[model samples]
Target: MEDLDVVAWIQVSDGRMLAVRSRGRDLLYLPGGKREPGEDDWSALSREVREELDLELDEATFRELGVVRAPAHDQPRHAHVRMACFTAAYRGAMAATGEVDEYRYVGRRERHLLAPAAQAALDLADRHGLLA
Candidate 1:
């Protein structure tokens, strides 16, 4: 089986959590991406969030939320993804950039619209009282 190791930044406000849709993709995903070969969690997550959302994550403020695994989005059934998630303060307003085409804050009712990994993250956040 193939495994995709990636990082995600979990940003929730009010009752909604941040989600992004990549260009030409239908499902919304948590805001982060795959780590490069040599990058640690903070470095990789910060870079990915910056590239996708145009926000600078404060490395000093990062708090490890949790890790979640699920079948990989848009991949074969034998593939899976392991997402290392964190929450942190960020600088600047977030806007879609690069491969990101759109973004929205979604709640539990919208879980069906998210990719599997994102849905798992959402459930975890809700269980931890991170959601409204």
Candidate 2:
């Protein structure tokens, strides 16, 4: 088994966060993907968001949310994932770009719908008052 390192874009609006359902996964997660080797955080995030949601994020609007360590999706508990999460502003319409099957904006009340790691990250954003 190979370990996967992922970078996620956390889009917040009106105290809500964005999550997307993967093509074959049951649980929804933050919109992101595994980073390509040698790619920096900003580059990977931009590419992943474009690939997953067809949204291009403005680099200038990017804000570092935080990192979270949790069990890898569909993987064993011992296998952990280190997610480097970020928040950014975009001007395009939000839609699934085939990589994702569906999209949803999760507010604090709906945070339970997110995966544990994603929920933790969301909590951090809430504490910081980043969800505007």
Candidate 3:
């Protein structure tokens, strides 16, 4: 089976978690992406957040929330995605960038709109009382 190892930023505010809808995509996803060659979790997550959300993640404040694995959304059954999630302070206003088309703050009630890995992250966050 093929596995996609990626990092994600989990930002929650006012009882809702940050999510993004990429261009040409139907489901919402957490704000992060695949690591580049030789990049570690912190660096990859920071870069992805900067590129996708136009925010600078404060690495010093980063905390590993949890890791979630699920079948790769829209991929073959043999494909899987392992998402390493982190939460941290950021330095700028959030805005859609790169391939992102829209941004939303979602709560448990909105889980059906999320991708598989994002849904897992949401469940974890809610179980840990991270979701307001």
- Candidate 1: segments with Cα more than 4 A from true spot: none
lDDT of each prediction vs. the true structure?
A: 0.91, 0.81, 0.91
The better-scoring model by TM-score among 2 and 3 is 3
> Cα lDDT of model 2 overall?
0.81
Candidate 2 clashing pairs?
14-132
Backbone clashes in candidate 3 total 0
Per model, how many backbone clashes are there? 0, 1, 0
TM-score per prediction, in order, is: 0.95, 0.88, 0.95
Residue lDDT tens for model 2, 1-132: 445567888887767888898888877798887778899899998988888888889999897878887767665633777788898888688789866999988888877677776877787778878775
Which pairs of residues collide in candidate 1? none
Q: Per-residue alpha-carbon lDDT of model 3 for 26-76, expressed as tens digits?
A: 899999988889999999999999999999999789999999998788656
- By lDDT rank, best first, the candidates go 3, 1, 2
